[model samples]
Structure formats: C-alpha cells, structure tokens
Target: MDTKISVVENGALKRVGKVFAEAFGQTPALLVADGNTLKAGGFETLRSLKEAGIVVRQYIFPSNPQPYADEYAIQIVHETLKQDNSIAVVLGSGTLNDITKRASSELDRPYMVVATAPSVDGYTSYGAAVSIGGFKQTLPCAAPLVVLADTKVLCKAPTDMTASGFGDCMAKFTAGMDWILADLLGVHPIRKDVWDMVQTPLRKVYKKRSSIARREASAIGILFDALSASGFAMQIMHDSRPASGAEHLISHVWEMEHLSKDGLPVSHGFKVAVGTMTIRYLYDQLKMVDINSISLIGGESWADRERAVRSFFKDPKVAEQTVVIAKKKFLEGEALSKRRETLLSIFPTLIKRIDEQLPPYAELKEAMRMNGAPVSPEDIASNLEGLRHAVTGAQMIRDRYTVLDLFYELGIFDQALESLQLM
Candidate 1:
C-alpha cells in the first residue's frame, strides 16, 4: 500500500505540481508519456511540476506503434532511471504506467501516476502486468505513491478506452464470485474489508453504465474510483486474489499469444470482458450439475496433464513454466478423492454463493453490451475454439483455485467447455 495520495476529480491535473510537491518535496521528477498521452496531459503535468520548482526530465515514447509493457521497454526505462535520481511521474494509463511501475521498482523507488484514462486497475496495484520473454505475467512492483486523475481528461479519452475500463470493472463481479468459491472451499477465505472495498464501487459503476457511455464526468469519476479501489484491495491483500481471478488468467493466456485485431493489440479489458462472459456462462451451467451425479472417481493422470500443457503451449519456456505450476495443483489418487469430497461437502454453499454473487448470465451479457464491451468471443478477435483453448490454458497457467479448476477436478472440464454456446 505505497500510495499516499489518491484523487479523482474534475481538473485534478491542475494540482499535479502541488500534489507532487506534497508527496516528494523538491525532488526532481521524470515525466513519462508517449505522443498520444503527451497530448492528453503530459504537457500540463510537466508545466505544473516546473511551476512547483521541481526540475523535470522527459521521456516521450513514440506513439505510432503504441507502447507495450514488456521486458524491453522496462529495460529502456530502467536504464533511464539508472542515470538519475528523479522520481517517475507516469502520465498515461495501462502500458506506460506498467512500464514505469516495473522500471521504478527495479531501482527500489516509488513512482506517481496521472491517469490518462480509466483503463485498467493496475494503476495502484502492487504487481505490474508485463510480458517477459513473450510470456505475460504479473511481476513484482511497488504501487505508485500518488495517483491523480482528472475527469476533464478522462471524459475526453477514446470511447474504447472508457469502455475498456468498464469491462475491467465489470470483471470484479466474476472475480468476486471466484473468490467466494475459494473462500467456501477453505482455500483462500475472503476478507470482509477488502471485499467491500472493491465490490461496493463496482456496483456503483454498474448502475452508472449508461452515463459512463455518455462520458458524464460523475460516471467517469465513479468508474475511475472503482478501478482504484480494486488496486487498493490488491494492495491490502498483497495478492491479486482480491482483484483478479480466472477472468484475468484467461486474459493472461491471450496476452501471451499477442491476441490482436485490425493490426493492433487487444486491450486487456476487452479480453477480460470476454473471459467474464465466458466464466459466467460456465457458472450458469454449473448450477445445473448435481454434485452427487458428478463422477470424480478418476481424473487425468499427471503424465496426461503434462502432455496437454506441453501441447497447448507451443513455447518450450512457457510450457516449462506452466508444467511446474500445473503440477502443484494437479490432484490425483487420494488427493483427488479428498478434493472431490471437500467439493461435495461444500456443494450447497458453493451454489448459494454463486447465486448471491453473480448476476444472471443474460443480464451480465446485456450490461457488457450496453457499456460497449465485447459480448462474444468474436468481438475480441477470438473464436469459440480459441476461447475454449484459452480457458484450459488459463487453468494450467496459474495455481489459483477457480471454477475452471472446479470443473477440471470434477473430470468434466471438456464437457463443461463444450456445453458453452458462445457463438
């Protein structure tokens, strides 16, 4: 929880200098942005810092190709920071902030952010979602010390960016349900305070979806606040379990493969939106299953599981990493029996939590559609087949207990996946 200052308001960008001065008095600052984000708020941020008597250095990444959060980008920023003692003030949303988060963390320094969009929740989270060796993962990083977002700027952000943020916010519904499943099964119990921190604002944003589409300042402010609350929840828990679940894991799998459309990489929120819908559909299907009827007597052998992981992930390095993680939670023999028994014992409670936690599948889909989020796999430059693979791959990539694991453990993962009618 390194963040000391968090403000989302109209014209908050005007307070950048004052806020920076308060957070890091008289410290020289490095302003980071790309061409598009530079126009968004970089100049104002620079001007404010200079007016506050702070020396400022600039790192303007080219905007044509759009910056990505990758090891190479982190290296460039890492080298830049190595040459000076200036604290970083990242001026964009997801990509730029992620790069700076990892780069600054490498030097054991805290950074600040002036959000250009309500794009993603990694803004004040403890881990940076980045690609290393072409594999997407969350790398350790310190959350920003100060987070400032001006609704004036946010309301003008590209509609898709706002929609992306909305998608990410909506994901909390499914992510929270996943947590409930874990908590009920005695894997990772929910923390009441952190649960309220994220879930409360999520509902507020859901109510204001239409206003958010209209880019109403109040609605955008609510979206931004909800996104920040998710980050704060992760900070408090020191694990993404508070803010991420299987939906994010599905996004990670797609990110690893560089899922893109129309010559541009797909936004994280778009990918997660699809995952959210997909997971919710699975939850609906889960309700129809009778725990007594499920035959969990035999399951995939470890050797077969290893083969599937190796075959699904083409890159040997990725396959290697996934195999290691998959091995940790691949239950069989007595372990499988015990897990099945526990699931059976908790079946009624699991269904109860799912009922209370998730919206109806059709209603959830309508919400995503009305908010301009992708409602089908095709909307994300992925097909049903690709999504199916992504779901299985997602299960293998993380040891996190999710509904994916539940079906897999029940020995009906393929049946469950095939039952999904996401055309």
Candidate 2:
C-alpha cells in the first residue's frame, strides 16, 4: 500500500503551515478547490500554508455543483501543472478530491486532501470514479499522501450531502456480505488483512455515531481513519471489490441518465443507500423461497444465460443479466466445485468478522440519524422511477462478480426486481 499519512485534528489545520513545511522541505503545493470550499476554508488553509513558510499556488472554480470533476475541470488542473512542479492538495470533498487524485496520477506527483465534507468515500481510495464522454467509470489514480477532515467543516456541510455519505457508508454492509458470497462461490479471492484493516475503524466509528453527528473529535477521527484505511485497501488489492459492489453500479446508472430531483442531482452515496435496501430486500425475499423453484414460476424470460451484459439495456435488463450469469454457472459447475466448497468453508467466518466491523442497516440508520445522514431512497433520488432506473443501470456496467451477478446466474433475478416495488 502507498504510504498514507492522515492528520485530522480539530485545530490541526491551523498548524498546516508547520506540517507542510516539515513534510515538503520547501516544495510548493497547488491548492485545488471549488467555490463552495473556497468560501468554506480555502483562504485559511492557504494562509496557514504560507505562514509555515511553504510556497503555494491556488486554483478555484466557481461554486456551481456542475463545474466539478468532469474532463473539463481535470483539464484546467492538468494545464495548470505545466507551470510548476508542486504537489497538489484538494481543499474540498467529492469532485475536488477525485479531480486532484486523477490529475496527480497523470502528473506522477503525490497529492493530499483537506476534506471539507463527509460526502463520499472516493476521498482516500486509489481509483476515481468519473464521467468520461458521458459514461460513468472508475479510472486508475494514486491515493492521497495525507487525508485531513475537519469535523467542524463536515458537520457544517449540507444535510443532504452528509446523508449521502451515511448512505454510502451503510452500503458497505450489503456490499461486504456480497463479498463473502463471491468468496464462497470461488469467483474472487478475499484479502483478509485488507478487510480487517478497513473494518477496524469502521467498528469504532459505527459505535460512536452520535459523536460523528455532533462532530466529536474521537468519532470524526474514527470515520476519517476508516475512510483512509478503505483507500489503502484498494491501493493494496488494486481493486475496489473489497469496498464497492453492485450498489455503486446503481449510482452510476443515475449518473448516466442525469436523473435529479428538485432541480439538483442526488449525491452518489444517497443512490447507493437506496440500492443497499433494494439488495437486502432481495435477500430477505430469497430466504422465504427456493432458488431452484424460481424459474418454474417465471420462465428464463431474461435474455441469453451465457453472456456478461446487454449493451442495449432498459429497466428489466437485470432479468437478462441474470439468465446469462445462470448459464455461466451451469457451465462452470464441474470446475468450480472445490472453489465453491472453499468459499463456503470461509463464508461463515467472513460474516462473523464483518459483523464485528460495520453496523447492520437498521443500526446504521440510527447512526445516520444521529450523524445527520439521510434516511430513505426517496431522500436520494428525485422520484421512484429514478431509483428503479438506477438499480437497473447498475446491472449493465462492470461485470464484476457480485451478489447481483450470483442471482442472475442462478436465474432468480425476477425475484429481486419484483421485490423493489415494495420499497
């Protein structure tokens, strides 16, 4: 894993000048931020850096939410890099962090983040999910050298954004469970060390949910630690399988469709939160039915059960994806026997370990309420149609082996879809 130095003290930012001076040895830093964050704390951060005798250059974009982390925004940072050899520092959350992460990777320079909100997990992750040519994808990037979050700033963030973060964090429960399933099926290898590292801070933070909402030092510190550890997990594994799963894909669909409510786009975490519920509902329904008996009720009406995806997708594409996955499993039956058995042997242990780390959805929601996070799918999407569309969208991209793929291969997708209507 890349060396991650996280400094997130309440008044620690005031000492940023001294910190930067000590770490960089006179090397200058390019401060990247958008208007909202500039107004929020960019000036103070800059002043502190200069006060510590560190030379600095600053870039600020207008406050419009749309002017963030697109190819155009990244271009400006890329072009600015031509003028100097300075490490980059993002003074905002979400887009600012993503753009800087991508830009710094392109420049082959280390970057750090001064997080102004707890809006998303891309903060410390090694890969950045961005929209390129109107398609949503996760592109390779380097993790930040340091991650600093001021709880004061995080607590002051817009309530919806905080809710989005809560939603994203909660999705980890279902996502982690799916990871266990994939391990059982022998589709992928699970990294026990990485899993434990990211999970430790998660346990501490979840237990202190009210403190996070109140911006208590210890609680915010734990959240920040877990977030950073998550980034490191991706850095070490070189994949997001340990972190994001189908829930993130659902969010991507919303991004591609440009869905919004009340004239504003919903945050990524918010979309995933609802997707989490939808997936759990699917599992809950499954516990009451027999997987083998599924097709008898609904014919394998999905598309061909031998392919990975459908280039032309609509709301019911999940059904098609399911049939395709099911056929693949049928073919792999003989070869995957040992692997499946190994996964089964370890799955119970994985679930037990995960429970020790992250909170369940119900408990997670209570934590969110305490931390000022949002509570429902309606809270993230503009309307019900948008939510369903995003969930369907998630099915199309990333042939990543996930629980969604598992049910699809098992020909039980229709069951998952029908369950969504109840939510």
Global lDDT scores for all candidate models: 0.89, 0.67
lDDT of 2 at 224: 63
Model 2: how far residue 193 lies from native, Å: 0.9
Shift of residue 150 alpha carbon in model 1, Å:
0.3
RMSD of each: 1.7, 4.3
Best by lDDT: 1
Candidate 1 residues 382-401, lDDT tens each?
88889988888998999889
C-alpha TM-score for every candidate = 0.95, 0.83
Give a tens-digit lDDT track for model 2, residues 221-329: 6666676666777788887777788777777666666667777776787677767666655555544544234322232332443333344354355447544544544
lDDT (C-alpha) at residue 196 in model 2: 82
Name the 10 consecutive residues with the lowest summed lDDT in model 2. Answer: 294-303
Candidate 1 residue 371 Cα shift, in angstroms, is: 1.7
